[model samples]
Target: MKAIVLGTLMAAVAATGATFSKSAEANELALSLCTYVQGDDTMRMRKKLRDSRVRVRDIYSGIQCNGQSLLQFAMSNGSQDIGEFIVGRLSVDELKSSGDYEWAQSNGHAGSPIAAAIKERAGL
Candidate 1:
């Protein structure tokens, strides 16, 4: 019985590790999607991020926001359409909880003055 219990525990740990690994991979994919989106490579962004199986926003959390939100990342970089799309998809609280709102309000739109004004206008 003890042996069986130990084996189960070990299996559980391995499974958790595997799950985390997958999450990390998904996070990387999401960041890549953002990069493509920022570059206005919508075709690739759509192709990469369209799958519902991936939690794009959750993966986005892993991205270095540079004290700015995903919206700021998109807007300041000339990806306003994608920024709007993400805003439409994400709930207000999700935006806040993700720290994007605070970052946007504080970071000055990743150092872009125009994006900073946009952020202020949007009430971010």
Candidate 2:
């Protein structure tokens, strides 16, 4: 009985550790994504997402860099290439609901190239 209990506890501990590991990996990926956007390294960002087998849309809502979404971050950083790339990957519904155009307009980025891309993508 003690052995069975110990085994169950061990399994639980292992599962918890795996969960934490996955969370850490996600955080690392988010940081890398933010860095790539900030640097406007669209190629590297694409490679990283492809290699990780993750799509931008899947993780878009989950990541916040400096209190801004990836698209917003890209626009703020003047990372037009990456911004367009991100905009391209997202779905029309996602783009429309993201309100990125309004955010950009209110944030003094209305004239940015990235804002134009957002408007085009969102069909705004």
Per-residue lDDT over 1-124 for candidate 1, one digit per residue giving the tens place of the 0 to 100 score:
9999999999999999999998887677756766776785766765676664654555555555444456667756777666655665555556656655555556565554433444454567
In order, how many clashes per candidate? 0, 0
lDDT by residue (tens digit), candidate 2, 1-124: 9999999999999999999999999999999999999999999999999988999999999999999999999988999999999999999899888888889999999999888987887779
Q: Give candidate 2 misplaced runs (Cα > 4 Å).
A: none
- For model 2, the local distance difference test gives 0.93
- Model 2 earns a TM-score of 0.95
Candidate 1 accuracy as lDDT:
0.63
What TM-score do all the candidates reach, one by one? 0.54, 0.95
C-alpha displacement of 17 in model 1, angstroms?
A: 3.3
Error of 2 at 110 (Å): 0.8
Clashes of 2: 0
